[model samples]
Target chain A: MSGFSRFTPLVNALPSTIPFVGPEAIERQRDVRVKARIGANESGFGPAPSVLEAIGRTAGETWMYNDPENFELREALALHHGVSRDNIAIGGGIDGLLGEIVRLVVEPGTPVVTSLGGYPTFNYHVNGHGGRLVTVPYVDDREDLEGLLEAARREDAPLVYFANPDNPMGSWWDAESIVAFARALPDRSLLILDEAYCETAPAGSTPSMDALIGQPNVLRMRTFSKAYGLAGARVGYAIGTIGNAQAFDKIRNHFGMARISTAAALAALRDQEYLRDVVGRIAAARERVAAIATENGLRPLPSATNFVAIDCGRDGTHARAIVDGLMEHGVFIRMPGAAPLNRCIRVSVGPEAEMDLFAQALPKVLSAVR
Target chain B: MSGFSRFTPLVNALPSTIPFVGPEAIERQRDVRVKARIGANESGFGPAPSVLEAIGRTAGETWMYNDPENFELREALALHHGVSRDNIAIGGGIDGLLGEIVRLVVEPGTPVVTSLGGYPTFNYHVNGHGGRLVTVPYVDDREDLEGLLEAARREDAPLVYFANPDNPMGSWWDAESIVAFARALPDRSLLILDEAYCETAPAGSTPSMDALIGQPNVLRMRTFSKAYGLAGARVGYAIGTIGNAQAFDKIRNHFGMARISTAAALAALRDQEYLRDVVGRIAAARERVAAIATENGLRPLPSATNFVAIDCGRDGTHARAIVDGLMEHGVFIRMPGAAPLNRCIRVSVGPEAEMDLFAQALPKVLSAVR
Candidate 1:
């Protein structure tokens, strides 16, 4: 267990805690293969066929480094969003970008704001940089925008994170409220507006790109990992002002991107028709999940995302048992980490076959847990 | 150009700079196709056919996120290196790992020691993390171990970087000197023994895995980018004590790895015979590159890497002219970023056709520069 003893005090004080235990880890630990992979909010329906073809065609070019500037990918992203490429910064995924964002703004003991039970990965990065966390609990299972703003101003915090169509709880705020919240934040506080689940959110739930493009304090994160079904591709981008985007260049691993993944993203963007078609499928699947939850005597939250949160009618332990019990049947799902939220179990949309597995297992798990 | 006005003072002071300009960018900027494609030190020979087959087959699974634990790949690498899986920490590439290492130990204004003409990307990471650099110049084209040690102790720098079979110069020190240098460092000073080229070095040039395993202050980095011919795959790992390796779990993008790339690394590791064969080709290409340099009346430095550095007879201007001149003929190559290292033009080992093009283009470019 000997480690370099001279690691910066911040690094030395941090514990090794992963944000999520991947389903694969569960398979290995429990010696059970997952049949319904729905826990991570990945698009179980997969990316378009054209993307797979692109990866196959580009496999031979795997020896050359990807363009560090990511010119083509950024241009495509910009074109899709009607913004300039200079306003885009690409990284391995939103997770990677979050780390960079945290590093750029957080000095030791700097107060950063986020909702309690928000993205653990962001909190991990903030803590890794020795930034003090000042969290506002979710209001009615939705991120408390007003509370977050109050905390940021009170603490004079330089960074705040807001996620629309939030994870775990599957709740969302209207676009106008979100825009108002962004405009009301102090210019001193940088806002990381994570729209990772926006593709699957209900209409009007996400602000238009133009609404926040001019705000230097706002960086909206988008990823191909969710509805695009390329979670394994590890492609994500942040849309911000040109100068804020360029800040990433100061410290990012210029050659860190995988060439084929870039190709996959390019292909994914080109196949927007497939994206539209899959978004429909995702909506249908979410309804199916909701229906299953309703039949199981659980209260399914109204969702603006690919996942639905089912109130398990008990404490955290009850939700935990149901999550573990479903996993025993190879039907994998997850629950929120912190209290009140943990009373619900989260289920992601998948194909009918996986949905059937979840349907069959949920009733049995509820019965067993009860 | 608007950016958040409240970024930490350290971030505001940093400039936007990339360590390396990729060849694709060169093609776009210079309005020319890279026919020879020997720039950036990427292997033009490409990955093995078997690895390509693996990527094609696994491309269908692009929907699932890579294992956050990287269990399978780490186990395979562990077996290959004859160490426990806990001894390895996976990263995007050596460049990515360097950034992480710098972040783990460096704070604002922290002093870091490295060779003056060493990898610009590593220095870029140190600066990105707000560390002040303390550079030791190369002696006889090799990184000065004594000077580095002296600087580290004098400045009480917590981090020092040394690359065996160094880049831009293709020079190396013997195993005995490397081991002695690692052991001589104060326990508080962490040595980054970058062995990115170890697979292609002379048999005794690299210390054995067990040589410095007991040193808590050392971490050796290896990559699949060079001899494994998977530069675009973005797979690299660090070898160190269990505790040191686990420390990465505290902050790394656990799910940032692309699934197909992990498959590519596993296949490449399992097919070491292919790697052995490719290393042979790389060595042959090095010799071919050296002969080409000699034919053009330049002195080719001895290389243990998949690239050769040819010292131009004049100054940095002469080297720059040759690099730019060769590009005019569709022969893409690069040179060191600073003098006296900038007096040399670097040519990465590639397929026979590319070498033929380099052989043809060099004399013409050299003559034109003259």
Candidate 2:
């Protein structure tokens, strides 16, 4: 049946495209099992066992809505970062928070600056809101800080998105460069510094929370979906000035956090020891993936995040063939959407068994695709 | 530190107000415990044991992102409702879905129609998107449907919201009138038929799925949060035409659903026997609440929902006093926000122990408030 005749023109103009195609969809479409499941940057090593216990214990309480204030989780995040709880705003994930941030700043024809192929979800949000995207392509697989700044100034764009320890390419800028970028943006422009993979980033790669804490124009995004290994839990938060965080209250699904997910996040936060250990495993898995890539004649890019982007030394179509070919062998991985970066395939870290499946499948796919 | 200086005029104009303050926030601010836990329309009786079991089973899989497509859940919902899978769109909850719907239809100063003091979350979403609300006050505690239709026509409103088994008052209209209302709306105006409480409503209170399925302008919302007893799970779906459902893909946080919540919802849907039992219990508890109100010399409104709204026989201030008084006794009942309707205190059905606590505390609190 046809839709309602009068959705706003902005909504009508948007393509019915999704940011990511999940492994479940892949499996259904291809009628093949995804044995490796090392895609989408999910932690196949899974959340800490303690988190599972918390979920089970809290399951019976699933009839209660989560606190709209998100007091406990925000408090825990505050104590962990040595900041005030008022600085944090919880959301479905960085993706959800990005939508709110876009809505808050972007009006129809407003320019929004970001790397050309950084995160499709962020782009999706900007497009959804009728913001004109001013793309700055990557410089050496790292987000082009200077180019983004130039576009913001040129368009007088009120919003700009920058992801440190970037997705797709799995590259990052040093702390100094990132802080400099935030400081460089015009005071009128809001900088959304997406730090979804920050917990896994090398020490010098992530800026200290205190470094940008008081910057009114900057909001740092973090997520449990990464190093915390709770992607399916859908818990992510934005850390910024209290006023910036409070702005989220003006337009958010206030009672939207899933109750058990909140409990799971609380338990996960309390278990810092687990997070530290998982980071070590992720680092090891990154190295393992790099080694596997190198052994199979692909060059794995240096990464500051949980995943590695392997250069296939060809164009988007060749990378697409490798992605499809690997999926045929029950290994699910993704590739960059645009040129240059699309010469690569991205694989997330997981348990050894899944990695082994990828290790076995990659060589065969490469050979067949050739 | 302050927020960014360049938010859109609309965002800058908005007050940072949450639609509903959580009971947890009340406990924190008032230094009281929620003994009865009967506010927020949440099922105090909790989710089915089988749903809890599903959560436990899915805990280990929380490392993976839920299928962005929400394919399985949509398929199950379609099978349950006798609609095609494309007819369903899943979200964090009905609250989240409302936000998306508002985003699609409302622009700055766009007139949207709804009952006065209806679901505040829906109104919250409308205002967030810069839509001007034209609220038609309830007539005799039920939504004035004819008034809403008139307002829709007069304002040429592109969007209107009405809930079946209405919140705050727990009042409802019969199915034929509702279907007629849907059919009579101008094609330019979209109808959001929020049926979040339908599971607890009487058989004829809701229009049959087939009755309005073909109407392009109508979208019916349902939740696992109510009689399915999974409020904290944050699972809700909108049923509409294929094109309408596809529109959600243009802008939704594609990977937003919590993996375990999806599992819990799937299990909840499969366990019809459990849902039937819970509906029976909810009805009995509704009766119990009415009896409690009668015994206290207050009037209880007729309800088609899990909660009963008791007329405290005074103004909003008196109702507020009763709510605050009951909280001092560890009872967490709530009242409507505006005038007239605010004369009532809303109490949700719960286990007998909680009802007994309410039964014990109400008289003393009412006396004190008086």
Candidate 3:
């Protein structure tokens, strides 16, 4: 446990832990292989064939450093979103971007606001920067916009996190309500509007690109990880005003991007036809997941993302037992960590073979846990 | 210039800037095409064919996130370096790891030490974390180890960076000297022994992996970007004690690695035959570059790296003109930033075609600049 004695007090205070243990780690830790890898919200359907081809073509170019400005990718993203290229700042992924944004805004003991059990990675970053977390509990299993606003006002927090089509619970707010929340928040409290799951949301549930682009205090996070099926590519971007985007230049690892990842994202963006088809497939898989949960006498909550949360009609222990038992059968799935939300076990959508394994395993897990 | 009004005071005071202008940016800014891309110290010979094949095979798995633990890759690297997996920490590149280290050790006004004309990206990260820089002047065009040791003691610096077979000047100290310097430093001053160019250094130059492995405060950084010729893959690692490696988990983006990039690194590491071959090519190219510079009446410094630094017989302004003049002919090269070092124009070793372009253009460009 010995470490460099000179680490800043803030880093010293933080725990060495991953926000989420990947399925690969689970396999190693449990001494069992995960056959059905429908756990990490990755697109088991995979990226467009064109994206793979793009990666293949770019392999020779891997000897060269990627363009530090990320100019070409930003240009393509801007055109896709109808924003100026200056409004886009790319990073390794939303997780990496969250770290940078926290560094820019949070100092020791600074107040930051988020849902009590929201994305743990963001919370990790805030805690790493020595920020005091002002948590607003999720209301009825959805991120409570009103509660968040109240906490931000009361604490006068400088940073607020709100994710549309949220993870873990897979709930969302309408485009109008999200826009209202962003507009009504105090301008001094910069908002990180995480739309990482917005691509899989029901139509009109996510705001248009133009909705918050002009708001200097609101930075929207989007990724090619989920709907684009390039999770391993590590490509995500933040959309904001030019000034906010430029601010990333002050602290970001300017040449940190992987060349093939950028090419994969660009190709994925260009192949919108494949994205539309895959999104439909994702929607169908979500339905299949919910149907399986219902058949097992569990209540599957409505989901706007590529996953479903099934209520086990008990407390966290029962949910935990079900999760552990399912993993015993190589049917990997996750559950929420905090109360009320932890009453449900979360399963991400995947190919039907994996769904069949989950369906076959869930009944036995439920009975054994009971 | 509208931005989030609540950025930390340090962020508000810092200017948004890229540490280095990439060749792509220079091409765009100068409104010319880069036909001979020999700048940035990237290897133009490219990675091994086996590495490319690994990337092709790994393309299908891009849907899944890379293992957050980075277990398989870590095991491979540990075996390669004759260390335990706990002794290594992987990052996006050396650039990204530098940022994380700065964050861990630096707070506002924390004095950090490095050579005055050293890597700009390291300086950028230190400043980003609000660490005040204490630069030791290079003695006889080499990083002054005694001066750096003195500065660390005087400033009580928590961090100090020393690169072997250095960039911008291609200078180095013998391994025994470097080891002695490390052992003599205050244990409180963490040493970042950057050996990014070590793979190409002459025999007996680089200290063995075990030399300082037991030292808690010394972390040695190595990259596949240089001699392995995988600059765009963004794979770098730090070799240190178990404590220092695990400390990265307290804050690093756990899933930030691109799957294909890891595959490439693993494959490239396995192909040491190719590495030996390319190192030979790099040496020959360096000779060619030095010869071209000498023939043009410039003084080419002795280099143990994949690049040569040629003194242009004047100050920085004269060297800058030679660099710009070469760019006009699409022969892209760079120059050091600080005075004394700025009298040299740095040129990376490349394929003969690029060297041919540099050889063909250097004389004409020099005449024009003169």
Candidate 4:
């Protein structure tokens, strides 16, 4: 247990904890091979054939480090968003970018605002930096936008996080409401408007890029992990004003990008037709999940993202039993960590085979849990 | 130019800078294609065929995020190095791990020590964390061990960085000397023993894992970017005491690793024969580069790494001219940034074709410069 005795006091005080336990670890711990991997909100339908081709073609070039500037990907993203390359900053993933954004703003004892149970990874980053968390609880299963704004104003918090088409509950706010919320925040408050599930959201749910591109206090995080089906590739970008974007350059690991991953992202970006087709599949899978939940005597929440949160009609313990029971049948799924929200189990959209497995396992798991 | 107004003063004071200009950036800025990519010290021999196969096979799994724990890779590495899995921490690469390490140890005004012209990326991380750098100049192009020790003790610095078989100058100390330096440092002074180039170094040059694995003050970094020929894969690991290793989990983006890159690293690790073969090729290419330097009447510094630094018989201006002139011929190479070292241009090992291009371009560039 001997360790480096000179780590900063902040680091020493922090616990070695993972924000989410990966499905692989679950499989290992449960001693059961995951027959249906519908957890973690990963796109089991997979990336486009063109993206796989690009990855294969770029395999030979893996000896060379990726361009540190990420020029090509940024240029493509800029063109796609109708902004300059300076408006975009690429990172390992949204998770990685969240850590950087937190580091840029949070100091010891700094107050930061987010939903009570929203995005544990962001909360992890905040706590890691010694920032005090000021959480606004979800209202009607959606992030309490007004409460977040109030907390930011009252605490004069420098940072706030809001996820569009949010995880766990799979809830969303309309583009107009989101824009209004951003504009209402204090000038000193930097809002991380996480749109990780944007591509899968219903039309008009995601705000237009131009709406907040000029706002220095707002950053929109989008990822290739969801609709593009490349979560494993670790490609995510933040869009903001030029100065806010450049702030990432001040502290990011310049040579940290994986070359093949970049190629995969570029190809994924270019093949929008495939993305469109995959989005269709994801929506259909969501419906299938809802049907399965309803048939199993659970209430499936309305979703704008690629997952459906099923209310198990009980408390967190009952929901946890369902989650653990599903795993026993080799069907892996996750649940929210906070009260009320934790009364439900979260299941991601996957291929029909996985959905079928979930359908088959749910009744049996529920019976056992009951 | 407007940015989020609430960034910490440390971030505001920092410049948006890259430690090294990538070759791709040079090509974009200068409007030239690199015919011979010999810059950045990346292995041009490429990763093993088995690794390419692994990548292709794993490409379908890119939709899923990599395991947060990186359990399999750690297990394999632990087996390879004769250490327990708890002794290792995985990261995006050495570059990403350095940033994490600095965050764990450094805070505003914290004093950290390193060679004056050592790895610029490490310096960038130190600066990003607001750590005050205490530098000791290289003695005869080798990182001065005694000078670094003295500076750490004088400053009572908590962190020190030492790169063995060092970069830019490609000099090395024997294992005994390295171990002695590590043992002499005070308990509170944490040492980052960067061994990124260890695989290409001469046998017996790298200390055995058991020699320093038990030391709480030392963490040795190794990478797939060099002799493993997977720079683009962005996989690096740090070896230290179990508690020191777990420290990374406190703040690292747990799911940041690219799944394909992890597979590639695992495959590369399993194919020891490919590594052996590539190491031989790298050593041979190093010799060829030195011969080319000698043929052109430049003094090639003796190197144990995968690159050679050639003294140009003049100052920084002359060396810059040679570097720029070679780039005009589509041959991309780099030189050190500081005095004395700037008199040397560093070239990475590559395939025979790239070597031939460099061989052909050197004399013409030299003649033009002269």
Candidate 5:
């Protein structure tokens, strides 16, 4: 395919690899409609009724560009976290914010640290910018903090990414340990402490904004995509020092945010009661998913996230077969990309109807795969 | 204000600046509410009722991430343009796509060419990536295409941006001229043919998709923000070669698009009758704005866009005064930023209620400013 041949060498060398194949893509490719929709870690319970109402109320204003400063959302986020508005910066989602942070810090051949099977999207951004990856493998299904810090120091990496209440594995580190990890990193190494799943994590798993607000090298990412049930809204924010927050203004697409999405996020933030309710429901669903996995003769990893990782008691291929088999049954789930973690299949929490579909399909899938 | 001290040298040297101050920011800073929001060239007429219905239908699905491939939207856009799906690349908006294209081609010190008073957001993106801009001044109140081609050739610039039915000035080149210019550019020089206002432009002002589709170096950007009245939806697409379209996959935030925004765009595209109706409304509003300018003894430049630029017959200071003066009456409008062009104040097309507000407020604001 012919293209503009003068793209920067970094771009020319990069592959067109997506971080994840969405369920919609699967439906099209396989000609099978997804019945359960339990993949991709989205809340099938959906956004709060109030957020939907807010979207409806604001739909008529769709002709105006969203506020480029994202001032209102930032102010709300700051108030919620008990920080100044200057301490917050908003973006389309954590994925978009990650790209901005990577652009701000990483250059060609710069070393970036992350868990081997960590968030693929971060790695995708780093690689897109020609940042060399120095990955530390997960230790016992959890992001190995000590190993990550060691790698950062050894590589003199300018950027390190850590996810508490991680994706894929659904493992988490407590707030104290996470704080120590951030503090241990060199001041020269900026830490992208991704707390995308924080709302669904155990109480102690996420550090308070105050704990890292003063650390210029630390940027804590939070999103409405998880516990708030607005993943499609694509709203996320980063909490850092005022200077760090302002750094995004240096390059972010000021008018890139969708106005209704901003309204949805603002509404989602105001209704903390809804958030709490959803978090409880997510926890219950995770238990149901775990129970289903165990009954299917699989081991469910302890998860403080909105999903459960089931160890199929076999190798990567076995886990892959289970994932594929379940999708054939219209129960779409995913597995880790790399090994060790790939030996487990990841299942996102959904309503009982979807969970019932999973419950009904798991035994058939396992038997077929076996 | 402290931040990580080791951001990339380019990032370190960059100033934190926004391309445009949104009306909301103006409202906050000036302690006034914008009663007539025509400043940003957003569609004040709002999106079609059908689009609002689509948004409402999909609001619950805001819990899922938008398709990473943007499959359905791309397919719809391709069909609309009579191009293949591979020829279309989706983004948050034209502003977002500009940033991506700049990142793909521009590195530190790479030369870029554009009109001196061209889109500030494009300049912001180029500057953010450390591209040196070579600007050609507009001739006769329109972008001087010949001058732009000359500068691009002289600088060996890899990127050139030209907007037809332009913003701020609302001027345009004929479709023949635009097509010839694209075909004339060196293969190494990528032409960003920004047709953001194409839907509002007169027939034959926009080049046919087939006119430039096969060219690897040309990317024509279009948005649903103008005539479709979905600026807040943040949907835009680039038409180019298959390879050019796929190049975005290397670095774009694949999941960055909001789900409801995509739904809005798809619904809006399917309802071409609404689009035709709105375009006619916009044309009528533009004529009304021009009449208002004439009544106020200002020369209204002919516009093929949703906004009109009126010559204030003075200097930048006078135009600035008019912009600020309108704000005092709760009528928000804008002006071109650079000299020559800055002698004109820009007004956007809106519903008659807002037009009446502008019409009523213009004389008093002008008198006060005088």
Candidate 6:
């Protein structure tokens, strides 16, 4: 059967393509069992045991909708960051929040500036809202903040995206550079300073919450999916000025949060000891992945995130082959979607056992691709 | 600090109003402890023990992202309904799906039809998308199907919303009439036949899935939130043609679902025995609520849902007083937003204890209002 004929012109023009193909889809399409699940930058190290306990305890309360205002979670996030609750807006994840933010600003033909392949999901939202994307290439594998600012100015764009401690390359700019970029951007250009990987970033890499919290044009995005090890819980928040925070109230799915996910996030936040220990383990896993890549004659990029992007010493085709070959051996990993960046393969840190699987498979896959 | 000044005109024009006030918000605002939560139509009888067990088992797996395609859940639902997997599109919940559908069909000034005092969340999405709403008032406390059809045709509205076994009034139309309404609608008007309360509805009241599955102009919204007792899990789906289902991919947050919630839903679907038991409990609780209303000299509306709407034999203000009075007694019951319907108070079914609390509290609350 056909779809309804009356979908808006923008929706009709939008492609049906998804932002990212999940590892599960790959498993089905390739008919391969994913033995090592470290492809999506999700923490295979897992959430705290206390978080699991909270989910179990809250299991019976699954019938009640989460507070539409997300008061408790926002309050917890506020206290954790020393901001007012009004400064935070909770969402399903950074992906969901990006969609809402895009809808708020992007009209048909509006230019939205971002690094060429920063995050496909953000780009997906811009396109979904009929915004024209003005791309800036990565400089030294980090998001080109200066280029993004210039593009925003050139186009008088309302939206510009920069992911500090960037994905698909595991690159970052220090806190000072980031703050300067935020201050340099035109007030008309709303900056999405995505810090999804901030937790795993080096100490001086992320700016203090106070550094840009009062900035009207900047919103910092954070998620529990990465270092918090609760990707499946789908909890993410945006921190900015109170006005920017409540702007989400204008369009967000207010009751979109899952009760169990919220409970898990609260538990995850309360157990900072678990978080500290997990950060350490993620550091170790990164080293382990880098070592495996180095032994396979690949150069591992300096990373401030949970994943390592290894330069395959070849073109995109070769990198693709290695990625496909590794998946054949059940070592599922991802790479950058666009070229220059696609010459590298990205591997996420997981439990030691997954590292072992990747370690075992990489040598053979690299040789086969070579 | 203020928000970015360049939000679209539509966004600036939109109000930041939420659709529903959560019980938590009420408790905070009213400074009262809620001992009975029979206000939001949540199943206080809770999800099956088996669903809880599934959540516990899946807790450790929360670190992994749910399958972005939601292939497993879709396949399960397809099997359950004897439909093609392509017929189903999963979402965070019906609320989330409504937002996506509105984005697809409604643009600025686009006419969208719905019942007056219908699902506020649906209206919320329409307003968020800048769609102009043309609402048809209820006839005899039931949604006026003919009125909605006339409005859709007259306004050339691309979107029309109807909930079967409806909310606020707990009224329903027969399967034949609903099918006829769908068939009679213009092809340009996409009907959102919400079946959130379908499971609790009488068997003949719900049309077979085959009845309208082939209609491109019709989409059925179903939820595990109501009878299946997974409101907090935020699992809902839209059943339509393959084309309509795939349309969601153009704009949805592909990774929005919570992994544990998906697991819980799969477990809930598998435990149909538990579902049958809960349906019976809901029916009995409906009776319990009706009796409480009758004993208090209020008239209970005939219900095809998990809640009963009781007419207080007065105006909206009097009903509002009784509702507020019930809250003071720690019984959280809600009333309709508009007049006529607002003359009735809606009470959701829960466990016997909650019913007992309501039974005991109703007389005092009613007399106090009097």
Q: Provide candidate 5's TM-score on chain A.
A: 0.99
Q: What ranking emerges by DockQ with the best candidate at the front? A: 4, 5, 6, 2, 1, 3
Candidate 6 regions exceeding 4 Å error are none
Candidate 1 clashes: the total is 0
Q: What lDDT tens digits, residue by residue, belong to model 4 across residues B301-366?
A: 999899999999999999999999999999999999888899999999999999999999999999
Give the C-alpha miss distance for residue B113 in model 5, angstroms. Answer: 0.6
How good is the docking of model 1, by CAPRI class?
high
Write the number of the candidate with greater TM-score, choosing between 2 and 6: 6
Candidate 3 interface RMSD, angstroms, 1 decimal: 1.0
C-alpha DockQ for predicted model 3: 0.86
Best lDDT among the predictions, by candidate number: 4
B236-260 in candidate 3: lDDT tens per residue?
9998989999999999999999999
Give candidate 5's error at residue B257 in angstroms: 0.6
Per-residue CA lDDT of model 1 for A1-370, tens digit only, reads 8898888888878887878999999999999989999998988899999999999899999998899999999999999999999999999889999998998898889999998998888998898888999999998999999999999999999999988889889899999999999999999999999999998888898999999999999999999998889999999999999989998888788998999999999999999999999999998998999899989899999888888899988889999999999999999899999888999999989999999999999888888988
Which consecutive 10 residues in model 6 chain A have the weakest lDDT in total? A361-370
Candidate 6, residue B109: how far the Cα is off, in Å: 0.9
Candidate 4, after superposition: displacement of residue A80 in Å? 1.2
Which DockQ values do the candidates obtain, in the order shown? 0.87, 0.88, 0.86, 0.91, 0.90, 0.89
| Candidate 5 segments exceeding 4 Å error | none
Error of 6 at A369 (Å): 1.5
Error of 5 at A108 (Å): 0.5
Predicted candidate 3 versus true structure: per-residue lDDT over A17-78, tens digit per residue: 76899988889989999999888889999999999999999999999999999999999999
lDDT per residue, candidate 1, B116-202, as tens digits? 889999999898888999999899889999999999999988999999989979999999999999999999899999999989998
- Which sections of candidate 1 miss by over 4 Å? none
Please give, for every candidate in the order listed, the TM-score of chain B alone compared with the true chain B: 0.99, 0.99, 0.99, 0.99, 0.99, 0.99
List residue ranges in candidate 4 displaced over 4 A. none
